[model samples]
Target chain A: MTALAESRRRPWILRRRTRRIVPVAILAAVFVFPFAVMLFTAFKTPGDVFSTPPALLPREWTLDNFAEAFDQIPFWRYLANTLFVSGMSVLGTIVSCPLVAYATAKVRWRGARPLLGAVLLTMMLPPQVTLIPVFLIWNGLGAVGTYLPLIVPAFLGTPFLIFMIRQFMVSVPDELIEAARIDGASEFRTYAQIVLPIARPAIVTAAVFQFVWSWTDFLNPLIYLGDPDQYTLSIGLYSFFGENDVAWGPLMAACVMFTLPAVAIFLVGQRFFIGGVSAGALK
Target chain B: MRMTTIRRRRALTGLAFAAPFLMGFAIFIAYPIGASAFYSFTDFNLFQSPDWVGLQNYERLAQDSSFWKALANTFVLTATGVPLSIGIGIAGAHLLNLPVRGQPLFRALVYLPTIVPVVVGGYLWRWMLNSQYGFINYFLGLLGITGPGWLVQPEWTKPAIVLMTLWTVGGTMIIYLAALKDVPGELYEAAEIDGAGPFSRFLHITWPTISPVTLFQVIVNVIAWLQIFTQPYLLAQTRLNNASSGPGESMLTYAMYLFQNAFSFLKMGYASAMAWILFLLTLAVTLVILIGSRRWVHDGAR
Candidate 1:
């Protein structure tokens, strides 16, 4: 086995491994030190934050910044709004993208290839190219300043998610779909029962991505959500930054809160996140 | 006749499956693209209907100093940022591929920054890059070196943005890491038998193996940098009352300027023109990269 071979070769490899530790440590520090600093700063008092020589560890750790962050803004309201938008977006993306992906990847029809090409073309098109006209259209419909502008597009099936899901669906064996068809399954029934179960991983990947994207999306919300009542966490954070530019403690605390859900999602879905990205790029 | 009915039924079913995306594409993508093109040639604001003004918006863009400045600034960022990011990604990937202890933890540490929202990352960097009482300068002082006021100084602003951008290179690094896994250990063993040093072995074996991934990363990063808005927008525009570009417009990227034109100035036509230009530039760059990739990318056949 390769394990036996590797073990025999381990003496030389083991020596080289020790040499690698220094660079690995440096890289880890470079990447992680800021988050550590942010965490420490969030716990620090305002005086401790602005001390002459900045402290890596807080002199007296406190929850005052978190309390202040809440009092300074409608933090809970923005969080609820963000959750609502992101939830709707994830639901829409999962429902719609896979249906379209099935059509393009498995359905036997003359239009399927051209439809796939259109999806790829749309993926390459910049959102800015369509930004003005889309805004105008939404404005004409009186959807501006509402969550409609933000959430409605997800139902339409994003090109990137469509492409990614289609890529996954293409590799699914035709015999399985054929078996379902031979059993007199309806096209929709087959898609829902057989294909959807098989493509669960891809759907989860797409959902996680959509959730993170919607959660962190600033520009669309910035353009559409003019009312404070409709503002998501991203725009809420931006507005908070606008008001308290020098209030680093509360700002850092708010940022930590803003980032926690995304970080938690990433940690939980780390496997799918890495797999989805590599699959997207490599395919 | 029976066979024809079945074929028609299949096509109908396909259309049913595709209907949602098709409807969205027609309304959101197709119509918007056509309308944006039409709007590009018109003088329109949200207040009134558009008046046809052929090529005037493009002509104004040609002469607009701020437009030119945004274009130049974006190019500067893209030109420097893309290569620096690719370099760091490759180096980090190699470091990660080393046989070591606790590799998963190290990988996670490097990748953790990427999952953080840009809004949070931008604000965090703004604080750390603060001229006084910030950690970056303080850390530098420990080594007896003075750090500049990163966000305040015009010359340092773009580089500071680039550095912050590099912090999220973990995404690209992961892609390269995936590519590294695909490289054969036998190739390395053969090279080692031939008395090749580690650097030479990398150049001969590893470089060729990952060139395809490098091409893909380059195009993706180029498009991203071309459309960069949030990092600079958040860093420079702290207050709602002041939306001006920071410190001599150094942080004013093309996308931010386009957003400003559309929203702030209400120059819908002008912004449309800028967007079309950006689209064309993205297409041109992507084409050049694809064409140039023929020389360097090893497509596995050769």
Candidate 2:
């Protein structure tokens, strides 16, 4: 950083900041490049999209793909279903995870320690291990075509989210909970009135993750939601494969639309989402 | 005694709070795991009751060439893909951590792909890797290098999956970046003053500090690759209800195969058996990583 060191650097490449920026720029650009293609392809004419020598921009930009995507599929219906599922999922996480975190992290009870351990252990299990049996349970109740298989699990509690919230709740000063009780607040009162307010960051992180998971989820919906009318945007967008020829422009446009909500949520809650990478919570 | 009554009341309060998850675990998780184990040993296909077949499904999985291929493909990804992702991710984090303007924005751009809906990511890659008109080949063409048939050739499909996997290595990068930020800068300065080279300085300081996160990422990445479904599943689709597994079944991933046996073939018992094998495989690999990395994964207390 010294002026003398800067002036006499053997090569411009030895200029440390310039050297660093080159690779970083290339890496970032590589990651962002696909997204740029997705956006540009969405606007390109079909001919431009598959141009023999591919070009980044369309010769004549158009909105025809977005229109086609809507016409080709039940775009609005699928979007509505995705939003409802994601929103209800966020609602479910907000209501359930923190309460569970409270009991396991704040309250003094013998079961608390073992329950936390159980949560961690369960978090490590592969989803496939339980995939078939869980589906059977839903199918047995004749809830396969409904949103119950997806939405109801969030209300119960997701082990990962519960574990995350618990890690945050563990650091809550014991004095705070003790003081809330000293004020004659009941256990539920202390949770709802005091601890819940303090747990906003963790709750927001949980909401961001839950909303994205439900919105983007394919496997459960693919298996359980047999009816086209019940399909979320994910399953709906995937229907492009069923057709003989993939409409590249429309597919790209639908991909863009499908990606936006998750990106928006991530942007809005960027801090909490990134901050939830606590070393303890992950392992 | 009043003390015992108060204790009982406190226990009840905690129980009320934890009830939802506990009941959820019992019915949804514990029950399914138990049921799956029982079903793994039987020949139940949901049309009728399970008939005990002892070790038949497990034995059949041994003879199942599809099972071996799926296992091999998954291992290739995990063995090659996970390490490459971790290596590139860590290296990328080091570069991103260099003193530069716009560091935060660069960091976020790297993570952007990780959050893109996986299905969207899959379909976009399918387009992007198209041999003729795909951007990848187009770029390669510009470089005067003929790119291989990325997703089309059976030999190339797994590499395509790995390529896609690397694009999202940013998730691993961010986690390592967080760990990197925790390393005391003074240690690096001290090492530099002692005339240590960059690699040695990194060897002594950075690796030791971030090894825990590395261990964590390794285990997590292994599990993810083992259960990779959506990418291969999406890529292999040619028509509705026509189960294809890419060129020569190259894309028949373990989870996908299990899904086919259970749902498509109506072989619930067979699928359940596959589940248990997957569980043991996961457990064994996880243990190997955990036990193997003990010397390297600093517990921080040291």
Candidate 3:
């Protein structure tokens, strides 16, 4: 009887162990393996990159690919361009979205509900539907190839960010606003001083999201930024792919460079990143 | 009169606060939508004046084989990709929820891919899926399995795109993880006390609790997949100047085709028509999902 029980318990133990190991292994392999391959390829020599049986690790890891990528593309210029665009976008979103959110969330006005509804409706409308007219308008204004088309809209407030900030603002106690009013605070002053401070988390979430969106935006830049000098990293990378189609090592290295800032931002602001995603979905 | 003036003052303050966004919405969103709808009915190539042509663009779309093919491709992608992604997301969330030592690290690792610009991710996958030199086939070869030329073959291209898109399932997975955290532990404890197995407990308790989240994810994923462009576009449109579709036009998604019409072919009117159609289709799908969800989605209140 003891032997039988021990034998049964052994399978259960093994099963539990396998269960623990299997999921973690699969997660690592699926989620982490491609990145490892990318990093390895970035450092690999050109010869190793296209080798018949591709070595996961480089036979000779070198910085030549990164050097080559830099030489081939105006990496620093594009990085600066991306930073400028993203910075402007983040500032625009943070400034405009919170005010709109405040009005919709805190202020009792007849148009507030309708405006909120419109915001939600706009979120569902395909960007393509608006593509032609917006592009045409920008073209008419001669804002194409400039950063105006990209940066200006961000200042107007994005529906999603507005919705998110509004959700956060709705939970702010009315007493605080009342107290601010009693303290002789103007409406704008109450917002700038009291509401803004309390809504820092949501604002941070919006800033991070807008920064990432602007940094990674392909379609907008692809459409508007015709000047190579004005090119962001995304478009620069695409152009690099075009010119150096067969140069896998340098291409991967360029990709690694392009991806690093976003990854760093994500890692640093991971809590906000996770929080923003949930809020967008659940709210 | 005093109360009325105060109400008016509050209203003005509210409008002032919302003015920037309201103006932007009017100019960027509302105006554009209206203009696109009008343009859909008119023949407005960039160089020419828009000729009012009622239903001609839509009529042309009806007979356009490429438009139909693009529609079919988009449908197949959304039909298959959304469910598969949600399944992967849920499973990934469950795995992360396991009593593991480095859960946060694992979660972060999973989310890392999503932050990578879509362009970078697309190129990375293109390199990885290269039949001859790609590590994917190289790894598969270890098990003596020959992988198909993913980008070269029409039959395999969509599936390859699906695989590439799934790389960013981390976003959805994170959402599911948040939902999983909200599941009460007592219910699981009760299930365990009743000798319910893990799978049984999940089916009975965990799934119902998270069904609302699943519904939300499904709609979001469906909309995303319907508008799928960048992955397939990068995979197929490698040449900077070339506007041709990839390998039997297998990777010509609806949005890609619409883009070609608008930008490449300069069929602005036709593309506008396609956009309107896409809008209607998205609304229909979302409505169906929202309406259909009532049967299965369990509100915790119930």
Candidate 4:
């Protein structure tokens, strides 16, 4: 009995057992294994890709696939176009969403309730519903095949972004806004000075989220941009797939190139992604 | 008197701040909705001005056998995909929320797929599901079982898309994890004291608490699924025959069909009609969900 008690009291044994570690490890492997294969394939030559056992490591490491992918798709141009559009959209969404969110969350007005309801309703509608209509309108304005159709929407506040920021805005103390008001600050001035500065975290969160969405968006670019010069990375990759005949090595290389911005952005701005995703749950 | 002036000025300022969005909505949104409805009444190819034919597009849509097939494929995908994704998300959240070491690492691993572009995800999944050289098939072969041609076979294509979607459940899991955090520990403790087992406690306590979130997720996911395009487009293009008919039209979603008509075939009028039908269907489904919210969504937590 004493020996059993002593064994139970040992430091390692005393630690709380998860009763789940093995299963969770298995689940984690399932989640991660495809990415492992993708990374491995990106290093190989096209000739080695369909080898019988599917190598986890290349016998001869080569950058040939990456070079081929680049040459085939005008990858650098697509990357530049994608960066310009997605970067601007992030900047524009961050700038505009807060203005609307401030109005809804901080101000009391006759139209506030109705306006807020409108934003929520907008979130409910799938963007696909508006695809053709929006296309025709842009086409009529001669904006089709240009970046304008893609960039223009960012200047207007998105309802989903507004919803996220407004929820964050609700937690900002009314005392701060009122105190600024008493200090000879106009409402706009208080928003600029006090509210905007404090809402930086949420703004960053919105920016990162918007960047990911815009960067990865295939349909909007697929529809709006007619010329190859204006194509973003998503469309570039699509054309890459079409040209490559599903060449696993070069395809994976191109995919890695396309996905780098988002992965880098996420890693850099992880705190915000976690925070913004959580904020959506409160309401 | 001074207060009245301040209030009036504030209202004007509000309007000024909101003006850009309003203008964009009017020009880009409202104009197109009305114009698309108008176009649906006509026969328009891009080169030619629309000729008003009045309900002809709708009649043509009814006669379009491919439209019905595409619609059926979409329904089958959403019906299976949404529930499977929700199940995976919830299970993942439950596991992540438990007190465990290396929690943040696990969270990051799960969230990684969401950051990859959909095009990349589709291609990667295609390789993983390949019949001959795919790792999945090889593993199955070791067990004396043969794996079917997943992306190539018409019967298996939609299920293949569904499988790919399951990889991104991390997005939904993040939301569920946040909601699960708000579930009170005391309720679990009480249930445990009453001799309720883990499964029983989950059904009685956890399910009730998370039901609203699940409902919200269902609506968002269903609406998103109804517009499925990227997976089908990629898979269809890569299918062996190089066919636009898309794997027995198994991969031909409603959006894909709209795309084909609008861009490929240049049947703008017909595509416009299809878009309107989709819009109305989405609006109606959303409205029904909103009306039914009180019946299922428990907002009393606030």
Top DockQ prediction, candidate number: 1
Candidate 3: give the clashing pairs: none
Per-candidate fnat, comma-separated = 0.77, 0.71, 0.80, 0.56
Flag regions of model 4 displaced more than 4 Å: A1-19, A242-244, B1-4, B238-243, B287-302
| Cα-based lDDT for every prediction | 0.90, 0.87, 0.89, 0.81
Model 4, B199-226: lDDT tens per residue?
9998988888988888888888888888
The model with the greater DockQ, 1 or 4, is 1
A1-283 per-residue lDDT for model 3 (tens digits): 9877886878886578567967776885787888888899999988888799888899998999999899988999999999999999999999899999999999888878998998898888889999999999998898888999889999999999999999999999999999999999999999999999999999999999999999999888888988889999888886555444567788889888888899888888998888889878886
* Candidate 1 Cα deviation (angstroms), residue B247: 0.7
Taking chain B only, the TM-score of every model is: 0.96, 0.96, 0.97, 0.93
Q: Which candidate, 1 or 2, would have the higher lDDT against the true structure?
A: 1
lDDT of 1 by residue, A1-283 (tens): 9976886778776557677798998998999999988889999998899997888899999999999999988999999999999999999999899999998999998789999999999988999999999999999999998899889889989889998999999999999999999999988889999999999999999999999999888888888888888778787776555444467899889998989999999889888988888889998
**Best-performing candidate as measured by lDDT:** 1
Error of 3 at B258 (Å): 0.6
Candidate 1: where is the Cα deviation over 4 Å?
Answer: A1-16, A242-245, B241-243
lDDT of 3: 0.89
Model 3 bad stretches (over 4 Å): A1-22, A242-245, B241-243
For candidate 3, the TM-score is 0.95
Clashes of each: 0, 0, 0, 0
Report the C-alpha lDDT of model 1 over B21-47, residue by residue, as the tens digit: 899999989999999999999999999
Each model's DockQ score = 0.71, 0.70, 0.69, 0.54
